[model samples]
Structure formats: structure tokens, C-alpha cells
Target: MIDVAEHLAAVLEAARPLPAESHDVAAARGRVLRHPVRAAVDVPAFDSSAMDGFALRFADVTAVPATFRVVADLPAGTDLDPTLDTAEAARIMTGAPVPTDATAVVPFEDTERGLAGGLDPVTVVAAPRAPGAHIRRRGSDVSAGDLVVDAGVRLTAAWIGAIAASGVGTVSVSRTARVAVVSTGSELVSPGAPMRRGQIPESNSVLLAGLAEESGAEIVLRTSVPDEGDGPRRAIAAAEEAGADVVVFSGGVSAGAYEVVKNTLGDLMRFDRVRMQPGKPQGFGVTPRGTLLFGLPGNPVSAAVSFELFVRPALRALEGDAEVGRTSTRVALAGGWRARPEKTQYVPVSLDRTDPAAWVARPTERGPRGLGAADGLAVLPPRESDVAPDELVTVALW
Candidate 1:
């Protein structure tokens, strides 16, 4: 038997970041950047207008009810450059390049015509208070060769927009970890299929594959095999041939006579009983070909908990993420319950958000019904007896 912390530490130490790969910026969302992304060109490559209005010298609009000759009309994406002089203006649209000598912009709302009619003889009723108003200066947001985003950043929508704004069409990101999910049990059948007397719907593969993708791992293969002879071994070989970086087996890891995973792969992997509730039997090892393997418990809740605690972090590490664990918060317990002695327990909980600053955790059962309503897992340390209400506990948000 080993402590939970010790097992996690070992797993993280064994996992290393995969090699970097280049990907299109459009397909780079949710991937960790392996190298810093530098701006290829200055943002707003040229001085542009921030509003649709008249672009003229500030002196022309310093006085109210002033008239100026409209020199030219500048719409967006136009390449013509018309200079603005005293008592002269240009009808400019939003995102249009600002002409040289233009110090201010007066919106059409301040004029009587208001872009509804001809602009040869435009009237400026209000004066722009200061110079350089309503102008988005060139290179103001980002300059050429500037560090747009640093390495190890998880790409989000905003990050993608920034990268595109920098004129970068492609980016270097960490390779997605290829994963294979193998659910072992002879009595399991696929959903929507006819079930026999001792058959149950196989759901662990779906659960594990979803969790793997959420951690940024790409699902390369997902299959279920029986506990009979050579079934588990053949499934593992198929995964290895598919170029999987990690193979996760959801059952046959416990101490039982018909434990296919234990009886077959026990010599190649290290199986340990971590001091944790619902997911104590855990196994992990690297094959001779350097592919990682994880053997989790059979129960649905136990498999989910084991993936969250052990497999998720390993996948994150493989993707070069600096922060791998789920976000945790200290909250007040809404009720009391008995806890197992000398074992840490991860109890499903629903948060009472009426008072956000003082969140209350309502415990739920260890079944699928409770899991459906749970927003997080309450991490309860080993205790001699039952815990009381109002006690503070750390809850790891999913």
C-alpha cells in the first residue's frame, strides 16, 4: 500500500512532455504552446480611425458651428491617402486609415447632414476637445517582434485572436497526447445492445475517453474486451500499434481470481493500493516501447475519481502544462457524515452558491445520481470518526 500523494508524485515524475509540433492557428485552441509566439507584424499596421466621422485638423473644429470643405471620402480598406489641412475635413469611416496631418475626429452626429447627404461642404457643430482623439495609433497594441504570448500558455479564443492579429497563421504547440481507452469485462455490453442475464452496459470507456479529451489528450482508440484468455493482451497490443502514448484500462486491476489485467500485466506494471476511498486499487507502468499504462478500478464512480486524481495530471504533464491539478477552494461543510479511518476520501458534493464568499458544501452519495448533481469533489483527509457540520474542507472543482 502507498499514500495517495506518493502515488501521484511518482506518476508525475514518470510523465514527460511530448515533442512539439506545428499546428494551424485555427486548430490550436486548448493546446499548450511549446514556444513563445512572437508578433510577425505590428497590430493596426497603420494609423486608423476608431470611429466613423470627419478627420481634420483640431484647429478646424476648435470653434462650434464651423464649416470646412470636405476634401475626400475615406472608407475602410481604401489605400488613398488624402492630407487634411486647416478648414478642411475628410469623411472617414471606422477602421479606415487616418490621413497625415489629421489631429482629431468629429463624429457625424455633431453635423447637421450627419452622413445622410453630400459632404462637400460639411458643417462641424461640436469641436473635438483635444488632439489625437479617436485615432488608433499604429503599433500601439503590439509591435513587430513583440512577445504576443509566452510558452506554456493554454490557447483560448482570445489568444487565437491575438495570434491572428499579429499576422501569424501558424503556431508551435505541444503535441496532443494520444490515448487509448480499454475497458475490461466479459459481462459488459455496449449501450443500445441487447443484454444477457449477467450483462451490464459498458460505460467506462466513454467516461474515460471524455475525461482524457478534457485534459487535452487525443483519443486514438477506444474498445472493450472480455476478461477471458488473451483478450486484454491483444487489446493492449492494438493500442500500442496505433501509436498511443498512454493506455488506460478501467477494470480487472483488483485482487480477484478472474482479474485479467492483474493476472496478465502484473509482471510488467506496479499495482498498488493507495489509501483512498472508492479508488484504492491503482496501477501504472511504462511498456518497453515507452508507452504509459494506467489500470483503474471497475466501478463507475471509482473510475471517474481515479482518472481525476491520477490520469488527468499525467495527461497534463505530457502536454507541457504548468498547472495540472484541478482548481480547489476551501468551503464550509453543510452536513456531517462518517469517514473511513486511515484513508482519504473524495466525496461528491454540490455547492450552495447563495453566499459566494461563504460557499456551503452539501455532500452526496457515491452513486451516479450524486455524481450528476456534484460540482466538485470534497477532499476529506483521514479521520478517526465522523465529521461535523460547518467544518472547513477543501473542494476540488471539476
Candidate 2:
């Protein structure tokens, strides 16, 4: 039997990222980028007004009570000729293009309406204002040919806004991998259903499905099987028929009298009893239809932890993400603890960083077999026992 870390390496080594597919920028949120995204054109595109004010020459005004005749009115998206001189002031609205020779903008509220008698009323206002105060310079935000986003970055809301503002209406991202989840147990009943004596509700299927989704895999099929070998085999057959790249089964892989999943899949799939606690029993092999199959433990906590520490990374690898693996951190044990020398122990523990550089690890009351209500798993090294308080221990973070 291999160690926990070595087992994970073997599983991750078997997966690969899916191919890239073109999708609309609006629909690509949360998906991984498959190619670099370059700016389509100048972000600002043209020199325009940033405020609803009068566009005029910076040198035209001397002091307060300075006046200029409004030559032309320009609203947003309006195109104007570049023929304005120092004597000309254009009435520009916000987002409107600035006419040539304009260096400042005087807001309309700053000026008062002049006499409306027979002449074109000249608005009186203060001037000799600061340059570039209200003008949005062309290419100020981004140039015409700048790279906006690079490949391997996950698309976020801000990225969507940036790509759209850069004139990119579509984006290319990695396609999501399709997955199927199957649960096997005769003692399990659906939630809210009346249970017989000694029966438990089914939960591993839903948990695995959620885990798969978090790892960027799409769940296309979900089903449950009885604790009979024929029932589990039928579920696997159905999962393959649904065209799943990966098929996950829960609850029938452990060592027990009624381990139907192991018995059924062992004939058509490879079975391996791992050396880790809570999830020591496991199996994996290719389905008859060529889909990857994983038989997870039956206990809720064991199944959940095993998927996070093992199966989730494989799904991430199949989604074009390079950072695909469990993250481990060194933590100081809060209390003294001991473990067996041969079997790898996954103890549930709560961690805190009271000091910036040190992590405090507090072991939970739950044992390795009792993982359903655990906070997270702590990897106990196989070479030692009786870890002291404040001793450094490596733990896998969720």
C-alpha cells in the first residue's frame, strides 16, 4: 500500500485538461482562460469629456467673471470637427468628444445664464482652469494594442468588465469536464423518506456531486444503487451510458460483509485498499465504455475527505488548471497526540494563526473513523507518535 501523498500523485498523473472552446464573454465567468486575450482597440477609443461642462481653451480665460460664447453643443457619441480655435468653446456633455484646441472644461453649474435679449447670450463663468481636469484622454485607461488578460487565469467579474471594455465581445475558455456520481448502499434511504430500523439516509452522492462542481466538473448524471453487486454494476453501466468522463461511486468500497461495490467493480475495475485511515478502502479503473471509475468509501466524512484529497485534483487537472493539488501547511499541535507507526492517520483538527508565522492546531474529538462531522483533516506522519504541543505538523487544508 502506498502513502497518502503518493496515492494522490498517481491519481493526478492520470488526468489532463480538456480542450478549449469559444464562448461569449458574458457566459465565460468562472471558467479558466485557454488563450491570451488582447485589447481589440484603444480602451477610450477617442478623446472625450469626463464631465458635463463647457470645453474651452485653457489660455482663453483670465480670472473670475470671464465669459465665452458657446459655439456648438456636443452630446455623448457626437462627432465634431477639429476646427475650434482659442476663441471657440464647445458645450460638451459627459462622454462627448472634446473639440480641437480645448484643454479644460467649465461645469454648467459654475456659470450663470446671461441676458437672453437679441444677441446669442454669452454665459459668464470663472476660467483659467486646470488642464485635463474634466477631459478623459484617449488611451489613458488602456492603449489600442495592450494585452488585457493572459492565458491560465480564471475569468472573474472584473475580468469580464475589462475584456468587454477592451472591445472583446467573446472569449475562449477551457470546456468543463462531464462527471457522473453513483451511491451504493442497501441501508441508505433518501432524505425525508421514512427509514426502516438501522437504515441511514443517502448523502454521499449529493456531496460528491457538489465537490465535482467545485472542482470545475459538470455533473450530468446522479443515481443510487442497492447494496447488491448487481445493483452497483447496473449503476456503473448507467453512468457510462450517460457519457461521463469520470464516474464516482460511494458507500460500497469498504471492508464489510456486504461490500457490493468492491465485489462488483473488482471484476471490471482495479481495486486498491489504500493505507490511509477513514478512507483506507478504495478502487479505481476504467469502465467498460472507457470512462474513469472511482469507488469511494461509504461513510459520509470518509467519502467527502477522500474526494477532496484525491478525486478533486483529478477533476481540476481535466479543466486546464495548472495549480491542481491539495494545499498543505505546517501547524503547531495544541496538545500532545500519538498515532500508530504503520497506518497513515488523517485526524480532524481546527487550526488558527494566533501569531502571523505560526499555525495553532487543535485536535478534534472525532477519530479517523468518525470523520462526517470533522472540521478538516490533519496528516499525521507515519514515522513518529506523541507529537508535543507547538510541534510542527503538516496538515492538508480544505
Candidate 3:
């Protein structure tokens, strides 16, 4: 049997970062940026008023009740640069461009007439605290040629807004991965189908498809085929025709007599028994066309755990993300149980995070109360002895 970490290393080695392509910032949301986004122009582009008030030279406002001749009326979005003489001012609205000679702004409420102040004579009842007060100077938020967003970072809502304000209309981002999910087993039938004594519902496709999408991959194809005939090969052909970059197959990599996936793709992929309980049988390979292939266990819990340990990180790396592994944290066990001998055991657990500094992981029993109720898995190391209560171990949160 192969070590789990060795198998993971092999999977990641086969995954490559997709080529970068230009995309509109709106279309690039949730994609990893391939290049740094530098501001082409200042955020504000020009000096503007932050309040509806008088835009005048500060030298004319050191004393209260200073009188001035309002020379111009500037509203938001107007580009007029009116000239001002000594003791002259402009009646400016919020977001309007200030005159070139203006050094400060005092709100209309600070003036005797307040909003009644017109584009003419007005008296200031209060003085501005300092020069350039209430003014959003050019480049104050972002300057030209500033790095607004760094490379390899995923674009979220906040990042999208920053890109929009950075004067960059288009950005380079990693290409989205097209994934296909195929589940192999003759006894498996679709949910709600009439099932005989030996038949079971085919649910691995749904599980793998959702996990693939959550990792930033687009599901290009999904199919379920039996162990007999050419069904598995046909499904893979369809996936390739649909431009799939990865194909995940479940239930046919084990040492069963009728292992369809292992038999059909044996020439391209290599099957391995990883030293991990419940999901040890694994298969992985890159096809001639460079599409990755993965084979997982049939059991739902095993399939999910295998995906979390191997597939998720590969998918993330394909999108150029630097951090690809699940976020693992050390937590103390609320209670302990005997561990599987000589095999890495992943036990479903519910974490008590109320005491954040001292998180306690409670192991749930296998079956209905196990994986379904778990938000994480406490990764118990390979050992034959029973784990003691309050022992510290690493847990990978979903």
C-alpha cells in the first residue's frame, strides 16, 4: 500500500495551472487573477468636493463672517474649472470638481444662508479647520500605477469593486477548469428508480459534481454507467468531446473481480491502495489529451473523504491558486475511541467552537449519525492503541 501523502503528491504533480486569459472585471469574479491589476489613473482623477459647500482659498476664511463674491456654481459630475479672485468662492455640490485655486471647503450649514446661499454674494458664519478640508484630493484613495490587486488572488465582491475603481476595464485570470463526473457500478440506479434487492441508488455523481463546482470547476458532463460493456469508455469519450479537463470516476478502482474502470483505463491510469482507512483504493492518471482522471471508492463517506484529501487541492492548483489544501486546525478530542490499526483513520466529527481557543472535536458514530452530522474530520494518525480523551490531533474542516 502507498502512503497517503505520496499519492497526494502524485496527484498534485500532474495538475498544472491553466493558461491566463483576459476577461472583463465583471466576468472575472470568482476567478484567480493571473497578473497584478495596476491603476491606470487616479481613483478620483481630479480634485473634488466632499461636501456641498463653498470652494474658496483658505487664506480668505481664517476669520468668521468673511464675505466673498460667489463666482461659479459647480455640481457633481461637472468639469468646469472656474477662476476665482481674492475673497471669491464657488458654490460647489458634493463630488463636484473644485476650482484650481481653491484650497478648502466649508459646508453650506456653516454659512449664514446655508442652502439658501446662491451663485452670488454669501457670508461665511464659520471657518474651515484647515486648508484642503472637505476635499477628496486626486489619487487620495489610489494613485496611477498603484497595484490595486495582486496576482494569484481570487476576485470577490470587494476586489471587483477595487478593479472597477482602478481604471482597469479588463484583467488577466486563470482559465476555468471543465470537469466531468462518472460513476461506475451495474447495481447502481438513479434515485427514485425502481430498485431490486441487489440494486442501490447512484449518488456519487451528485457528490463529486457539487464538490467540483465548489472548487471553482465547471461541470461539463455527468453520467453513470454499469460495470459491463463499453459504457465507461463511452462516457469518457463524451467528456473529452465536451472539453473536459478532468474526469472523476467512482467505484471501479478496487480489487473487485468486475472493476470496469480499472480494466478499461488500465493502460492510461495506475491503481493504488493508499494507507487510509475506508478510501484506500485509488486510481489516477493524465490522458494523452492531458485530461486528468480520478477513481474514488463507492461508499459516499469514502468518496467524499478521498475528494477532500486529493481532488480538491488539484482543482484549486489548476486555477493558479497558491494555497490549495484544506484548512486544517489542531483541536482536542472531547472523547476518544479505538483507532484502526496501522492505517490513517479519518473520523467524522462535530466541532464545538464556542470556546474558540480550546476547540473540542466530538466524534460521531458511523452510519446515519456519522458523516451527515459532521462539519470536519479529525485526522487520527496510524496507531493500534485507543486514543485518550482530550488528546490533540489535526482536523480538516469542510
Candidate 4:
């Protein structure tokens, strides 16, 4: 038997980041960058108007009730560069390039006529705007060749937009891991199928596949095999042929009789009883072809817990993520619960956010109902039999 930390460390030690590949920036969300992304061009490449207004020298509008001649009309995307002199203004739309001599912009609302009819000589009803007002200066947000995003950043929608604004069309990011989920059991049947007295609908594949996908892994193959004959080996071979980087097997890892995974790949894998509740039985090893293998318990909750505690971090490590673990925070317990002695317990819990700074965790309803309502798992350390109300506990958020 090994401790949870030891097992996790072993798993991480065996996993390495996948090779970097160039991908379109539009499709790189949820992927980690292998190298820093530098801006190819400055944001707001040229000085532009931030609002639809009149562009003129601030000196010309220092006094209210002043009149200025409209020299030209500048709309967005115009290439013509008009110059502004004293008492002269240009009707400029938002995002239009500002004139070289213009030092201020007065919004249409601050002037007479408001450009409602047409660009004509307008009277300034408000005081002059400070110099350089309402102008988005060139390279203000990001200069050309500046670091737009650092390496190991998990690309999000905002990051993609920033990259695009910096004139980056493509990015080099860590490749997503290819995963294969194999559920083993002869008595297992697919969902929505008729079941006999001893047969049950298989759900570990769907559960594991969804979890894997959430962790940024691409599911290449998902299949179920019986416990008898060469079913398990055949499925593993199919996974290898499909170019999988990792193969996850659900069930048949315990000391029970007729354990298919233990019987088939026992020699090739290292099985261990981790000191954790719900998911104590675990197995992991790397194949000769360099594909990682994981054998998780069959029970739905146990399988999900094992995936979060072990497989998810490994997947993240393979993608070169700096933060590979679930987010956790300390919260007060709303109720009391019994914990297993000498073994860690991961109890499902729901949060009370009436006070965000002091969140309270209440144990969720037991059985399958609990799984649905749980927002996080309250981690109970070993040797703590009972918890009191309002006790502080660390919760790993989903």
C-alpha cells in the first residue's frame, strides 16, 4: 500500500509534456502555450479616436461658446490624413485615425448640432477637453514585439482576443493528450439497454470520458470488453493502434475473483491500495510503447474520485500546465460526519455562500443523489473520526 501523495508524485514523474505544435489561435483555447507569445504588431497600430467627436487643437476650444470651421469628415478605416489648424476641427468617427496636429477630441454631445444633420461649422458649448483626450495612442495597450502572453498560460477567450489584437494568427501550444477509455466486465450493458438480474448498465466510460475531456484530453477510443477470454488485451491493442497517449480502465483491479485487468495486465502494471476512501484500489504503469495506463475502481463515485485525484493531474502534467491540481479552499463545516480511521476521506459537500468570505460546507445527500448536488469534495484527513459544526475543512472545488 502507498500513500496518496506518493502515488501522485509517481504518476507525475512518469508524465511529461507532449510535443509543441503550431495551431490557429482561434482554436487554441484550453491549451497551454509552450513558449511566450510576442505581439507581432502594436495594438491600435496608429493613433485613433476613442469616440465619435470633433478632433481639434485643445488651444482652439479653451473658451466656451466658440465656433470652428469643419475642415473634413473622417470615418473609420480612412487612409486620408487631414491636418488640423487653430479654430479648425474634423468630424471624426470612433476608431478613425486622428490628425497629426489634433491634440484633443470633443464629443458631439458637448457641441452644438451634435452632427445630427451634417458636418458644419459647430459651436463648442462646453469647455475644452484636456490635450490628448479621447485618443487611443499607438502601442498603448501592447507594443510591437512585446510579450503578449507568457508561456504555460491556459488560453482562454480573452487571451485569444488579445493575441488576435496583437496581430498573432497562430500560436505554438502543448499538444492535447490522446486518451482511450476501456470499461471491462462481461455483465456490463450499455445504457438504455435491457438488463438482467445480475447485469448493470455500464456508465464508467461516459463518466470517465467526460472527465477526461474536461481536463483537455481528446478521447480517441471508448469501448467495453468482457472479463473472459482476451477481451481486455484486445481493447488495449486497439487503443495503442488508435495512437492513444493514455489508456484508462475501469473495474477489475480489486482482489475479487475473476478480475479481468489484474489477470490480463497484472505483470505489466503496478497495482496498489491507496490510503483513501471511495477510491483505495488503484493501478498505473507505462506500456512498452510509452502509453500510460490507469486502472480505476468500477463504482461510479469511486471512479470519478480516482480520476480527479490521480488521472486529471497526470493529464495536466502531460499538457505542461503549471497548475495541475484542482482549486481548493478552506471553509467551515456546516454539519458533523464520521470519517474512516487511518484513511483519508473525500466527502461530497455543497456550499453555503451567504457569506463568501466565510463559506460553509454541508455534507451532501448520500448515494447517487449526493453526487449530483456536490459542488466540491471536502477532504478529511486521516485519523479524524468526527467533525464538529463550524469546523474548518479544506474543499477541492470542482
Could you say which candidate leads in TM-score? 4
* Worst 10 contiguous positions by lDDT, candidate 3: 363-372
Residues 263-358, model 4: lDDT tens digits: 889767899999998899999999898889999998888988899999999999998888888899999988766767778899889999998788
The lDDT of model 3 is: 0.90
Please give, for residues 300-342, the per-residue lDDT of candidate 3 as tens digits. 8899889888998888889888778778999998877677777
Candidate 2 residue runs with Cα over 4 Å from true position: 52-54, 59-67, 91-94, 104-134, 273-277, 325-398
> Whole-model Cα lDDT per candidate?
0.89, 0.77, 0.90, 0.90
TM-score winner between 1 and 4, please give it: 4
Query: Could you tell me every candidate's TM-score relative to the true structure?
Result: 0.92, 0.78, 0.87, 0.94
For residue 259, what is the lDDT in candidate 4? 80
Tell me the spans in candidate 4 whose CA falls farther than 4 Å from its real position. 354-358, 383-385
Residue 327, candidate 3: C-alpha displacement in angstroms = 3.6
Candidate 2 positional error at 109, Å: 8.7
**Tens-digit lDDT track of model 1 for 176-231:** 89999999999999988999799999999998999899787889999998888977
Superior by lDDT: candidate 2 or candidate 3: 3
